[model samples]
Target: MLVAVVLAVAATVGVVLFTRVATRPEPAARPTAPPPATAKVVRTDLVDRVEVDGTPGYGAATPLSGRKQGTLTWLPEPGKVVDRGQPLYAVDAVAVPLLIGSTPLYREIRADVPAGPDVRVLQENLVALGYAEAGPPDGKFDAGTGRALRKWQKAAGLPQSGVLAQGDALVLPAAVRVDRVTAQLGAAAEGELMEVTGTERLVTAELEKSRRDYAPAGAAVEVRLPDRRTAAGTVRSVATASAEEGETKLVVTVAFADPAAAPESGQVVVVLTGARRDQVLAVPVRALVALAEGGYAVEVLRDGGRSLVPVEPGMFASGLVEVTGPGLVEGAEVVVAS
Candidate 1:
């Protein structure tokens, strides 16, 4: 009877153990930890730059017109570099030299001509040509001026008339590169004989009204040439007039510091740096997260734990964004989406 009791008790114990095993819940599924990807906040220079397509060529071409009308006997070849006292073209089989001056020749300059700015221009050119020995560049036509004119005429193989008529010479702001000869060889030397540009090469870019601030006068820029070479350039001028287009556009002219290093004419890339900051806290743009509330935030990682910290984003450049905020410092690790 005791043995029977023992067997029954053992069976009861086994049933209780099975029931406990069935009722006990499986260990809670282990919580998963997200995969880690991070980047370090850095302090470096950040620049806000705009890259635009540019045309590398001699800047705007100015039309060249002659005051005298005659057969265009000879013309300078395209791409010719003409300087002061050099022949721009031949009119009536006589070379019409280019003189450095801003005043156009309007009337005849003779021994008894009235004092004016045009007289001053002629006197300056004569002095530059080694004819005037003593005297300031006065705007007066006197005996001394007549002597200089006679000498110039003699040297140029023209009659020693001691007089300069309109169209006797071409006046230009400076030396130029012949861009094109518009008139035929035998065409009349009247209007728009040719077009010329400054001797130095330049790049022209059209900036939309929104980007006008990107290229300010005197701002330095980088130009990438067609041959894959780079050159340093300066913003020469910003046009006040807007180009006619669907959008308002401003013309920006850039001149190379070393024009000889620039390509003659081709497509180029112009990079204008608007603003820059140095030694600023920055992080990869991917590290920034748009906060649900407002503004931006970066995940600050510390001791294997990440906490979103609000930040003020400044210039965004080169896949990096300038960041500033409380608890954000250089060398701090930040979480970035992989």
Candidate 2:
């Protein structure tokens, strides 16, 4: 009977202990909160600018061919600036002067040649060179034209043939700078003679076809040179066709108002301005919070506490948004979601 009493007491103790352990109230559930990411509201100027890769060089190099079929006795050195009425190269020891015109002197321009646009080009050039007081009557090869030709030939130290030959002069649209000379002393001038470019320095950039309007003609821009210096530029031309053989990027040429402002060759950065906001309160665009009703608000942390302050957003630029509100001020901390 004593052993039975002891066993029964032990059994009752085990049951009470089990019930107490199971009935113990779980530790009161504690609320958990994570620290919010934050950023400071800043007051500054914001500019919406687009930067594109560019190359600084003399616009485009165009190949210059000689119409004269003879020995190349003279060629200009590379980088030489040749102007109107100047000798581009010598053919058969005869200097072929440069002329400003659109039409080439195809046929022999003599007093008997029929009146044509070529004659008009020759006559106008003679007038501009001061060889003649005025152009030929009705652009016809007349007695006045012969007198001007003889004067020009004499001034150039050439024989007074009184007749303009087919290879006597080279006509181009404007003044050019020699980029390269393919003809050597005594080489044949029947083919390519040299390559030339415009005298102005230009920055060429390949802009995507979709953003074609970003660089329209006459748009003002800033060019950051390879040396980190910046200069002012304007869009000179935007190619209507593709700039590459197998691409669709439009070629944009930006010209420096002063050609001397840019280097001859280097990589460049073209900054195009879109919009700007001056001295406005702004924050990282990610700092904005959407409201349940409508509009946007920012979770501002102040006095060791946080609250949502409604904000009116304005111009957005460079990953920042302009904000305006009664409570929004510079140096205020706002939450930005990572």
Candidate 3:
């Protein structure tokens, strides 16, 4: 009986051990996540910029009124570029030419008139037009001046009077492109006659007075055209305009580096670079990883492995962040969240 009991106890112990082994749950599979995406550490230049709206066209237009007192017999076609010594319009069948000067022809320019700045301007223009052979303009209407005036008059199909009348020629600062003909052909030539603008195409933009430093004169900028092309440009001028709604504004004019590349008319983007970094280690901004230690770090990938390296971030521009750190070479790769 004792031997049978011992054998029974042994068999029960074996059965219990087997049941415990079978009932034990398999080791839970540890949760895992795929590796993060990555990008490269590129060496590139960065330019911090401010973009603003700009309008492209021939600069501002100024009214070209008729200074001659006569019946308007002829007018230049719109879009005609009137240069110095060229006939701007005809007055009663007499051509009134264009002259480059600041002073208008308010009185007769002849030998008998008092010497003045207007005479000097006329003499200078005469010399420029190759109609006069004289020294620098002395402001005196001498015999040479009379000869030059007569020569110009003859060339313009007018009688050689040797005297410049009160309404002889029109004076403007420079050559102008006729924008619009405001006067009719048969109307009296007295008031507003036409509108003219500079021949060069320029981009005009309005900037808030507080942000004037963003686009100072002579600063370089990039112009993004309506067709998605870019062109180099320079800030030609900046002027303060009258305050509107109690906020002052600035008028900024930009000229194309190559005028041929400028479009005739369209709204453009003016990119003003405020700062630049050259030949620096850069990466996509997304590659920047915030650290729990109060600084930034980048997960650098090397030799099929990745390690987080602390980096000092610099200027951020064009979706790139300038980074600097130990062992951060140009060709190295960095982790970026997908």
Candidate 4:
């Protein structure tokens, strides 16, 4: 009877333990997130580019020379930064004879009576020619210099105003733009010449033939000057035919957009020939999954859950494709990996 009671109690205890163990709850599985999107591509219809090289050149050049056969009275070529409308060349071709003290430009500086043999000859010749009879054969300009001005004006068909006029710019044989003048009031000479450069112009560049096709019509360009400053320009002209220097061919001449910054002759520069776009979106090639519906799909992370985002793939590529899809903006976080 005692053995039976022990066996029954042991059985009841085992049942209670087994029932408690079975009632305990199990741990839940953690959820995984969706992947991100990354691709890169450029729209073919948008911007195009071309590259080239060139040297700066002036748009126009005017040459200046003496109008009369008088001596080259002034030597002012080497160190003059002439301003527009400033005088460059001067000659003392007076006729009727000037007073001893008449040099308009050099009133401060004491001038020797005879500047040199050539000047002396010029003075004598001017007096004999009736350009000026005022100054001594001392070869200096004086008050009588106006006679030389009148004579030159008459021969060149210019106004006898004596004050140099604009049309007189053409009378110079050497060819240049006239910037300024210091005519002796009474001095006389047969004719005189002076010239100045224009305020605006362009520099040309030579490019390689291989880069020619990319050289677009109306493409934007930059002209680099000797001072390391860059001026903007356009691709003005591109040659259809090519020139060969040994085995290499060269394309010729790219005109500048801005003439204000061009360098002096023989100045070399690089031509930047393209435009840039901003705020473009890009992604890696593997990030894209082609959906069965023929559209593109990317895994998006939203509300702590991963979901399939159907995207319209327009500009796609091998490595990275340019993406434009719904709810896609800069800084919008997306899951790139599963």
For candidate 3, lDDT tens digit of each residue in 104-213?
A: 88888887999988898899898998875533798998888888888877887987998887678888988899999999998888889999998899998888776777
Better of 1 and 2 by TM-score: 1
For model 4, how does the per-residue alpha-carbon lDDT over 159-217 read when each residue is reduced to its tens digit?
56544322222221222323444333333433433334433445555556566655666
Clashes counted in candidate 3 amount to 0
Report the C-alpha lDDT of model 2 over 1-338, residue by residue, as the tens digit.
99999999999999999999999999988888878888999999998878899998877788999988889999999999998889999988999989888888899889899998888888888888896643743669888888888898899877798888888888898889999998788988878899999888799888778787678789999999888889999999888555557777777899997677887777899987766789999999999988989999999998998899999999999999999987888999999998
**lDDT to native, each model:** 0.88, 0.87, 0.88, 0.48
Lowest lDDT sum, 10 consecutive residues, model 3, at 129-138
How does residue 258 of candidate 4 score in lDDT?
52
Higher-ranked by lDDT: 2 or 3:
3
Point out the worst 10-residue segment of candidate 4 by lDDT: 95-104
Distance (Å) between predicted and true CA of 46, model 2?
6.5
lDDT of 2 at 172: 91
Report the alpha-carbon TM-score of model 2 versus the true structure: 0.70
Q: Give lDDT: candidate 4, residue 133.
A: 54
| Residue 163 accuracy (lDDT) in model 1 | 85
User: Candidate 2, which segments miss by more than 4 Å at Cα?
Assistant: 1-47, 136-138, 184-187, 226-229, 240-248, 264-267, 274-283, 289-316, 322-334
List clash counts for every candidate, in order.
Answer: 0, 0, 0, 61
TM-score of each: 0.83, 0.70, 0.71, 0.32
Which model is ahead, 3 or 4, in terms of lDDT?
A: 3
